[model samples]
Target: MTLSAQLGIIVGYLVLALLIGLSAYRLTDRTAADFYLASRTLGTVVLLSTTFATLLSAFTFFAGPNIAYHEGPEWILVMGLMDGIIFAILWYVIGYKQWLLGQQYDYVTLGEMLGDRFGSGLLRGLIAAVSLLWLFPYVMLQQVGAGTALETLTDGAIPYWAGAGLITAFMILYVVLAGMRGIAWTDTLQGAFMLVVTWVAMLWLLTAIGGPTSATAALETEAAAHVALGSDHYTPQWMLSRALVIGFGVAMFPQVNQRFFAAGSRTVLKRSFALWPILCVLLFVPSFMIGAWAHGLDVTVPADGNVLPIVLTEFTPGWFAALVIAGAMAAMMSSSDSMLLSGSSYFTRDLYRPLAEFSSRDVSERREDLLARVGVVVFATAAFLVSLVNPATLFELGDAAFSGFAQLALPVLAALYWRRTTRAGIGAGILLSQTFYLLSHFTTVVPGTYAGWTAGVVGMALGLGATVGVSLVTTPAAAERRALYFDGNETGAE
Candidate 1:
């Protein structure tokens, strides 16, 4: 595509997103609940689309292909098929219960629900802190992807810093203006666009480069190792551990977790999960093929592994390439907006509320909304600045983010299901799990094989053990509190 055409396509997509945000703002109620959770009023289509789009971040759009380009089709088994089922199952298990509690208590954030459940402000703060630690990197992944994609597509016409700043600016504007409602509206549109464009681009590329059969034959003869697993790098243990980490981590992402409350009804949530795997199949199969085909074609992969832009520019027509780039931009923005909104909500509702002098009841909803908008600016700016450093490839940064969040999976499950779970037990589990993950991640204390097992999985095992052992020794939460979450019966005291 000509530089002007590609830039125009991308700018048009952003304008559409901005318009959606403005429309949603007109419809918004301007209350904290409405801003954060869309006033619990998302139907099946928007609910499913927003959740699916949010999950399919820049990592999925860009990094999936990049990994498949280098690591072979095993990336499909690890994230595409396995994570599809894993995240779907978690949505059913965790999301259902969370929706029930959120509806009953009118809770806006996970921290509020957990803190009230355990009657501990410290636990709430810990959850918020840990979520941000992981979420920040994930947001940065989107910024990095945006910058790299723009730079590659435009051939240095647009600088990396400007590209990152552009995305960050749009993200802050839309999120601060329309909140979750705007995000959901834009995500639904962007998700459908991305799915369609991806399939189209894949088909076009496959046809132009012979066919899938030809591509497969080429891969078999030239890049045979890319078709199979069990290589030195993709060990069985490594694949399994990586899958587990992404599965668990994705389920508990703050942006994702809050979607549980946004569902209009149980049926909406259930229908979304039912359709999730099918959507995964459609989106990922083509992505893997495109990457693998590029390898067979002997395309000179860039330093950052941005093979999609290179492939499109070389093989496709100008219009088609522009459309594909716009689709990719949509994917990044959709994920970025949700992350910005969720991160701000965590900071405002979870972190700030507890530390503030005023009672939550005394605080006005308007002020809470304003604080969250301020947080949107603050968090998005930080992520944008980090993206300028080019810390790592999209896949590497995402791996770290997912691993950190996965450590919370066991503790969350214990708190939700096990009546014996105590405040101290949950607290200790989070601390120890995060500490172990950091140690294993940054240092050589954990061996290669164990590190391949992923710091999150190892930490989760230890954390789960600590949670169970400590809870066994400590007092359980009072029956009244337990009944509130488990038995659906409140004692009026809590």
Candidate 2:
């Protein structure tokens, strides 16, 4: 297809997304809860599809395939097979607990839940701050993915920054028009769209190469190392640590965690997680296979680009290929819009509300509402600037962010289930584990691994140890605040 035709398809998709997102403006009420959690009323289909779309992002569409392209299909084990199951189990373990307590307490954000549990606003502020800090890269990654996909597909006529900035602007407007409701509704469309495109693209590529049998035969000759199951890059430690990082880390995402509060019922929540693994398998396998096929075809991808678009354009016809790449852009938009909306809630609920109360300032719901919208704009713009810098590859950037978020998982789990958990214990765990994890980023002198454990494993281990050991020695914050999470209003909730 001509560049104009491709741009038309891409631009038309972007406008459709914005229009769909904005259509929710009338349905959304003018309250913080409505804006943040869609008034806590997401049913199974919307919840399942939105969560599935929100979690995959540019990371899954681009980095996932890129890994299989360069390394091998063994990268499949890194994601769908392990991560899908692990994350689904966590949704039940952690999410169900949050939903149960959230009903009684009406908690809006994770930081609020944890802080109220431990009776420490300081911890709440710290948690919100850390979440925003890590969320920057993950948010920026969507822009990176969009930039790469469009730039590659259009042969740079769109330019990397143009694609990055276009998605940024679209997301900011979408979040402002409607918050959780808009994002979730649009996510259902995008989720289904991306899945169909991915599978069709994969099947088309396979058939174009003369069926799966012939494609496998070609791969064996051209990429012998990638054809087999094992890759030296995937050590047991790497696999285990990665699973933990993605499973626990993703649950802590402001976007995904916020979804916990949005579930209409325990059944909706349970069914969503139950279907999560099936969704993962449907998307991950085909996307990875498409990338592995690139090696068999001798496709040359740029250093910054991946195999998905390059291969799609090569194998599929002009209009179909354009739609496939646009579908990938939908993945970026679906994820980015959700992140901006959720990240804004973190700032307004956890930080700004508390600050206003502390200052003895009379703030209206209108003021908080405005602050939330402002938060969306600020996060979207900041992430766009970072995308221009192109600081790192999608995989590296996502992995670093995941590891940092995973540091919080252990402490969060302990606080929710362990009545013995104390303010000082979770506080120590958060500060110490995150402190060590951040140090490893700045200084290589801090060993990235010890005794076959990856840096993420070491960080989470520190958090778990500090939480359990310190809680054993410390006094509980209060029994009254802990009862909400305990069964039968037990006095031992302390």
Q: Which candidate gets the maximum TM-score versus the true structure?
A: 2
RMSD of each: 2.8, 1.7
Best lDDT goes to which candidate?
2
TM-score of 1: 0.95
Q: Write one digit per residue (lDDT tens) for candidate 1, span 224-331.
A: 888776677788878888888899898788988899989999889888888988888888888777887788886798667588888888888877777777778778
Once fitted onto the true fold, the runs of candidate 1 whose alpha carbons sit more than 4 angstroms away are: 358-364, 445-452, 477-480, 488-494
- Which regions of candidate 2 are displaced past 4 Å? 478-480, 489-494
lDDT of 2 by residue, 1-494 (tens): 79999889988997898888788878888887888889899999999989988887888888988888888877777787556788888898888888877888899999999988877788899999999989999989989999888888888888899989888988888888978898898889888898888888888888888898888778888878888777677677777778878888998988998898899998898778778778888888999988877877868988778788898888899889899878888878888888888888889889988999999998798888888888888888988997899979999889888988999999999888888888889989988889888888768867887766778779998999999999899888663265557877566545
Cα error of candidate 1 at position 211, Å = 0.7
Task: Determine the C-alpha RMSD for candidate 1 after optimal superposition of all C-alphas.
Answer: 2.8
